[model samples]
Target: MTKLWQQRLQRQQRLMLRYLRLVFNEFFMIAVFILLGGAAYSYAGYIKTLTAPLWWSRPLVLILLLVLLTVGHFATLLQAADSLFLLPQESALKGYLKQAFSHSVPLPWVLLSFVCGFLVPFLEIGGGRSLISIGVLWLSVLILKLGQLWGQVVQLYLPTTQFRSQQVTFYGLSLLSLGLGLYSWPALGFVFSILTASISRWRLQQVQQQHLFQWQLALNQEASRMLQIYRFFNLFTDVPQLQGQIKRRRYLQPLLRWTTGRTTNPFLYLNWRGFLRGTEYSGLYLRLLVIGAIVLLFLQQVWLALVIALVFSYLIGFQLLPFYRSYWDYPQQRLYPQPASRRQQAFLKFLTPLFVGIWLVFSLAAYQLWLAPFGWVIILGVGVFNVAFLKLYVPNWLKRHEN
Candidate 1:
């Protein structure tokens, strides 16, 4: 079982490395650096402004900790065939699960600590804690997270109702533990966390003894988990593992009428309809647009807001570029009367208005950030960017990946 798990883990890591290289390519890394630098600067400036604790500071901190508690899930790495092929070895699979649990902890622990470290300012300003006390609080939360992960693994063996009931109890204990840590004594929280983790360990042993392995449930969970990962990668590039869902979106149907005229290209109709009905392109566009708008609304610096807006607009455009060839798998599409060049023209026609709408929405959100002449300059810059991206970058891209 250990060797089997090692083989699976190595394969998964290789697959992940391939996708990670694609997802974190040059442009994305640069964007991440700029975004992180800007965010850190803004965070520091905001922290300086909080001279005193606000009324909601404690509650907000508690809520953040509560949310953080639920950040990690179990990874079983079990396959569909495992249910049949490994049934004879099921008794020994406990060791495999133990190894899986061990493998999962490091990531969540690092993430928990990283986020908790950022909350130090809030702890000091809001609750007036010393360094030592804050250290204790971090340890307490880390232990609670371990307990949570243990509970997750243990629940895999139990019935649904029992699992849910255990979850509620665990949540209640975590809430009380964190609340006490933040509000009362950090040491008290630490004590409660140790007890919680120990209890979960005990429950895990009980389940392993009493219950049978729930192979189908575990396989479904792993599938769902991998799907989530593939969905994120789908935003950057094509992920064969990820399948997009199509929706009717009846209200959006009226917007497609513009594609009906005799002068319209047939490809335009397909593009518009596909984008409106499918979750892939449409959902990605809306999520980026909404996130960009929110970021622009909050950002006080005009230049920073403009940079962020342009970055998001570029991302939306770049991601949607892949959708241009979305119909290539359909043999019928190849028989269309339109010339090859006309297809490119049709794509440009579809993209032009979309970029314009994005520009308009972003400009409106950043209106407050605009200074007299700089606003016009920013607008022109975005316009020029759209032109360069569509005319220069896109054609080069198509040449490189000629369908």
Candidate 2:
């Protein structure tokens, strides 16, 4: 029974479900979905911004959005090399490569389907709309997936340029038709998806008749090398030491002056280096600049701005942990003499600039309301907590473990 259960657990269907859950964990991806969906809902209200007037804007955003979706879809699949290469045999490679996440052809079609489906609902949600429109949107996705698999199978069997071109042509048409459906005839387009699926199936049958099934091993080293290159690029952007010098980062200049000609803590030095040298950390200040602008834009109300300001300060205070180990080589003799406490004043120092930015944003936001006075007092208290009092207080700081 246990062995049987284990087999079931390892089944492809179960794994696909697991992959779906993992994909949802991506905050940016989820945000993309919600933003697109929400944007569609709010688009009618935002029609004035369109350059081509009202009638043209609806189709324009649909087309642009479809393009974005298709591009994003292909990009996402390319990044999923791990999921694509799970099979061990070289002969079975063709089949595995042609599944739900395949990129070469299917992604564009899928993107189109999703964009069209989303647009259709918003563009034609009422007034005697055929139920087929909603149903056909889903049908189109199934067909696209089928078409992708068929194309891959054909590529494997025929192994010719002509077959590949056919796949590309089909994929392009799927996307174009989806866009058209979104603009005018969603119901007919949905049904058309089913027809597309049948054509894709027929194409697959033709390929199967002509070619033999064979598997190829996924190229592991190629994937690894590609990842390494990406990691190197990430170091330039994600790591702090590689950032270009910035004039606006003059606030950090004092650290260099204070440390010159004097012995300093290497850890402290590394932290400062990361703060100064890293684009991401420096980005915090830039974000602070933007947040103030956004708060005023979104919630012209005074209290909202004050709250956002207070929260922003706290967030900056808390997010400094990642910068603790950015630059420097450790010497054998170097060791921590004092225990690091979570409640240590070190945290407050890192948070001060963020808090200050928040205060400025708050002051600007609530310049007129009586709430400005209350917010000012709170800001003062937060400053004392972050600077004066926290400097003297020691809390539960986590010391590094000796491996």
Candidate 3:
């Protein structure tokens, strides 16, 4: 019986991987995301520049980014199988997640901390204490990752969900506590991280000791759904009519109203309209805002403050590319006697960088109190690309294959 279930689980694992491989292929272009991501983090001068605006900004952004570092370990991989939910045997599902996390959580922190550790040394070159803090920061990242993984297993099989809710607060506090290590005493933060990690392991043991639930399957289906959506959108060359299925969020009607209704091109209008209304783009917006808030939170210098804004400019442009591509059916775009496909491509010319600029201006202003020497460089980059670059290239590229 155990052998049979194990075989079933193995097959399920392969299926999940296939789904994942397909999704990754769609996002191959977006692999460049790491470059922009590193650009913001690699520059501590930027973090310091943004921090001087508010005393709280540094700790808050740093803490939030730390938590992101921790959570990301789990986010990186897909679960092997979810059909365990529909299976006959319960025990296999119960402890499965524990094994998975044990296998997965350490990698993200190790990689991220290594990157962070190197960056910190360069950023805080003169301060020995700050260097020690960076070292502790690297150690604490692994501890936090382990602790959070343990806490999540505890959340799964426990009798009540309330305990899971408490676990979140615990994780938040751990990050908040860890941030202090970056300041006064690096050693103390390291100790606290160890202690918290111990508590998470303890919680997991308590669940095991009590035999509270049967097993842990690949239950985080939401993550799988997100990957699936990204995959499906990759299918159609034009905005697959079905793309609307992903964009329509009735809850966002109030927010959708904020997008200007004046554009004659409905696709252009809807692309902007949908971008604002959907939870997907809100997250992107939220992340930009969060980055700005962090830089402002830790605003200690002039030159570094606007880096968040600059990177966000790139992010906004990259994410909006799909929307720009979908603007073909915009009515104003069809005013001339052009093919429907041609009209759509033309509308994309204007829409692509418009969204990017909106986010860039808002993100940059938070740190704009000083004239960061890099500010004009960013503006010039944005203008040149938005005007001469994207407009010139996208239209021609679309024309090459216009059927």
- Which 10 consecutive positions of candidate 3 have the poorest summed lDDT? 234-243
Report lDDT per candidate. 0.82, 0.47, 0.54
Query: Against the correct fold, how does model 1 do in TM-score?
Result: 0.93
Each candidate's clash count: 0, 15, 21
Residue-by-residue lDDT tens digits, candidate 3, 220-331? 5335544554444333122222233455667767644544445454454555555665555445545555544554444443334445344444454455455544445646
Candidate 2 residues 1-403, lDDT tens each? 2332235335634644554454344232443344344455446544434333245545565456434533422111222343345324434433434442343355456665666565553444332234565456455555555555455445545656777678677767677656645556766666666666677678767766666543231233234533443433332223222334434467667865554325343344444555666666656556645654454444433444444444444444434444543332345224544334322234344444545655566555545543544545444644554553234321232233211
- Residues 56-83, candidate 1: write the lDDT tens digits: 8778888998898888778888999999
Model 2 weakest 10-residue run by lDDT? 70-79
Candidates ranked by TM-score, best first? 1, 3, 2
Candidate of highest TM-score:
1
What is the Cα-based lDDT of residue 59 in candidate 1?
81
Ranking under lDDT, best-scoring first? 1, 3, 2
* Each model's Cα RMSD: 2.1, 9.1, 8.0
